[model samples]
Target: MFDVIDFLQTVGQDAQWRHADTEALAVALTEAEIDPELRVAILAGDEQGLQALLGQDPFCCLINPAKPDEEQEECDGSCEEEEENDNDKDKENDKGRG
Candidate 1:
């Protein structure tokens, strides 16, 4: 089996490959010795099909950190509150043990 990840990386890095026509992409996929099913999925732009073939589930996660200068005070207040609550819980547990 051809390395699907490497094939994807090659296509991703090359604008020409990424924008190639279906016929041209089919030729390239043939040259790359890609799996027939994967070639079909790529040609059809089938994200779910590609994921199934690659044994991957559709997943996305994004994290945007707050600006330190602008959000620091807000974060500090909430974080300190959570810490104090946790500390209180710990103290309560310690009293129970004693």
Candidate 2:
């Protein structure tokens, strides 16, 4: 998973947001793909809010925003399982062809 704090640092360093104001930073974060709540907290300089928001898996879309502290880890597990199944199928096909 990508580091939320690192991503935020990169965003802050980007030319577009280099000298951006609070509103601009918020817009940039919104456009960057994740929810705008984190941006809102950052602009407001609310450390606790930022930490709380970051606690959720930011990259996961299935995350229920209502429960920001708990991550829906099932998605990751299911994805890995699906990938393994695909690999196994490929191996079986190779064996059949051989």
Per residue, candidate 1 scores C-alpha lDDT tens digits across 1-98 of: 34877888888999887667889989988998899999999889999999899888888899988777764344547888999999999999999999
Each prediction's Cα RMSD? 11.2, 15.3
Residue-level lDDT of model 2, residues 1-98, one tens digit each, is: 15557768797678877677877766666666556676667778888788777675345356436477776564647888999999999999999999
Error in Å for residue 31 of model 2: 1.1
Runs with alpha carbons beyond 4 Å of true place in candidate 1:
62-98
**What's the lDDT for candidate 1?**
0.86
Give the runs in model 2 whose Cα sits over 4 Å from its true position: 1-3, 12-18, 56-98
lDDT of each: 0.86, 0.72
